[model samples]
Target: MTMQHPAFAKGHVAVVTGAASGIGLAAAREFARLGLCVVLADLEGDRLEAACQEVRALAAGGEADVVAIATDVSRPDQVESLERAVIQRFGRVHILMNNAGIQPGSSLFGPQANWDSVLAVNLMGVIYGTRTFGPNMMSHKDPALIINTGSKQGITTPPGDPAYNVSKAGVKAFTEALQHELRNTQGCRVTAHLLIPGFVYTALTANGRTEKPAGAWTPEQTVEFMMRSIERGDFYILCPDNDVDRATDERRIAWAAGDIIENRPPLSRWHPDHADAARDFIAKRD
Candidate 1:
């Protein structure tokens, strides 16, 4: 599919973290197919190398235009090294996808290590990638992008996994602030986008399931929706899955915010007192 965004132009450079699998791999594949010099950054291993080869096969310029850098985005030093390596190889980067994340099932009183790892990879990773690469991308004077992957749980602040919710919420807030800064920076052509995926059938979401659930979307479908949103100049690329549509997502988010506005109990949708009201509000139309 041809991309309409100037940032996706042929021969441009795109760096996608977590490119070894799922949405990151899907985005890298699309970029390579569009003739962009694609850099796949992930942990050092055979899986990363294999993903690089898959992207390379679809690259318009073949192997030369596709490279994989062993990177642990959670480490600031490693993320910095990734930026330097990409710059040295490609000279300039037109797209940066800070898409590395992890959700190892967190509880309110879970091991602190779980919280630490989740925040390190899901939130700080995005900050490191954007801050490390933003200046270089702006200096090139070309339309560029920084896409941060977030989650719906962040918006709604659901129960069951507090650490993952907190991490993704930080991503959403950080990406918003980053975009505001980019738009206000003089002579800067780079833009930031928040990609909120819903029920994507990835290794991160599979939870040992061999087959995708009926309600989940494939990584390719989510990436395709993200590209379309970017082409339309949307900052919040909120995606829908087989079980939900845009309208449902909107209502759910609104109900979440209304908890504060109406002075209701937190997560009132799940609270027995407000359950009927929440259901009716979501089912109602304007």
Candidate 2:
């Protein structure tokens, strides 16, 4: 299907981090298929090379249109180098998908290593990528997109995986602020979007499972939804999987906000004292 977003025009350059697999790889392939030059960034390894080949096969211009860069987005220097490399090869970039992220398991007081690594890659990576490439994108004065991958846990702040939740929550907040700044800036055409994906069966979420879960979405499905949302100019591209629909997601998010508004305990949806009340609230329709 043809994309409606102006920035998706053919010949435009699109950079996708974490493109070695999952949602990031899916998005990179789609861009290549759409005739845009694609840059796939991930840690240097067989996966990155293989992903580059996968995307290259779909690229209209073949090998010349697709390249892979080994980038540790958590490092500002690497992120800056990624920008320079892209510019040197492609001249200009029109679309940036800051989708590099890691979700190692974490406890509330987990090993400092887990927390640090998660935050550095998941949150700081997005920050470094945006700051490094955003200025030139704006200077181009062409329709462009800055898509930051977020998560549902960021919005609802679920109990498990506190480090993951905190990192994604920061992504949500930072992308929001970035969008606001982009919109208010004079003569700026670059737009920021937060891509909040549902349970997608990726390497990151495999958790040793050999087969795809019935309730999860494939990365392609998630990317298709994301493109449609971007075409519609949606800032919060909240995706639904096989198990949960948009209505249910909306209710859950509202209830999360209600915790503060109603003066209830944090994450009251899981709190013993508020379980029944939260269930009843979610059950009611508008």
Candidate 3:
């Protein structure tokens, strides 16, 4: 399905980080289909080239434009290079998607490298993308958008990878502040949005799976939901999986916040004392 945005017309440029795979790649294809010039950026050079070729092939008979750039989103220099490349090719960027992320499984008190790597890509990458392209979009009078990919793990604080959770949590908070500031900024046409995806089957979670799991959605499905959210001018593009719904997500987030609100022990959901309570809460909410 095509994304229906009045502001996103032919000749508009879109920059998507992590475009080599998953939601970023899906979004890139969608943007290209909508006649937007798409710049696909990723650290994997071969995959980035292949993804760009796919986009170009899809746009062969259309007016859509596509390009690929190898970039390490964790580094400011690489992000800057991507920005310059887009400006040189498309003149200006209309959509900036900070979607590059990595999940390094680690406990709360585990190795520091896990925390550093996850934060660098998931959190710092979003900050760099916004800092690099946001100002340019602000200078233009045309409408622009910034989409940051966050995860439900960040909001609900599930007990698996604390590094990934913290990084995505930072993304959620940062995107919120970005939207607030952008709306208040004088003459700023660029708008910020937070993309919260449910369980999506992608390379990040492939693990040699031949087909998508029953509870997980494909990247394309997630992007379709995201597009609908964008058309509705939603700030928090919270997605729902086949096994989960909006009500479930809301209750999970509320429960997480309650841990702090009620001054419960850390990770109350995993606490032996609160295990039964958490299970009952989830079951009742579901």
Candidate 4:
């Protein structure tokens, strides 16, 4: 597994948001294993400390460095502070993973707080993190990577949890525009990537469950998949878990596109009238 970018090499730095656990922590650990200096930020202080320790342990004795910060990604000042602190410590940042997210339940007429919280953290956090770190990365001579964590729901626009879907959809659009912008900018070496993860066994998705369901991939597995995707220079790093394959995901996304192209109802796959048809569509072997 050779590193595709210098960011993955020793002495470079990688910052991961929501790194206290799950995919973020797994990414940080993997970076440490690659000997990159890793900085972790999360809203949970104690868990962030534990994660920092875990990343430290992953390194061969004195092989890499880890920094931890208690950060609320939704706030601009906090995210800015995180960037400044990382720069102050490591001198430069070569990789930025805006992976912070929250999933409080929401509905069509749910409490206003749910929607507000979801948008602020899930959408605005990625926006702010990208804005803060992107320019600095572009200024440097090193090749840089920016990975914004998106969701499959963003593309498919599922029926349940409208707020979550909306937020992730924003991420998808923003990352697309970001990659385009970077590509057109002269002397810009930074590449933007959208990581659409499949069902992963993480705290946000656990819903108080003690065991990982069969369909879910571990956080480490997800990050490993992400690395491979990055190496391929893929803009949309869509992941498939145990329950779904790439072909299934492709069919589902094409059907979602058909909702507008073919004049079907929005999110028709989940609608009652379209259930059988959607099932039949999914059942197609080809």
TM-score of 4: 0.96
> All candidates' lDDT scores?
0.95, 0.95, 0.88, 0.90
Ten-residue region with minimum lDDT total, candidate 3: 56-65
- Per-residue lDDT tens digits of candidate 1, residues 138-211? 89899999999999998999889999999999999999999999999999999999999999999999989999
Per-prediction backbone clash count: 0, 0, 0, 0
Tens-place lDDT digits, model 2, residues 82-182: 99999999999999999999988999876999999999999999999999999999998989999999999999998889999999999999999999999
Models 1 onward score TM values of 0.98, 0.98, 0.94, 0.96
> Ten-residue segment with the worst summed lDDT in candidate 1?
1-10
Judge candidate 4 against the unseen true structure and give its global Cα lDDT, from 0 to 1.
0.90
In candidate 1, which residue ranges exceed 4 Å CA deviation? Answer: 1-3
Error of 2 at 162 (Å): 0.8
Model 1: number of backbone collisions:
0
| Tens digits of lDDT, candidate 4, 151-264 | 998899887799999999999999999999999999998999999999999999998899999999999999999999888778999999999999899889988888899798
Q: Rank order by TM-score, top first?
A: 2, 1, 4, 3
lDDT of 1 at 126: 95
Task: State in Å the error of residue 48, model 3.
Answer: 1.0
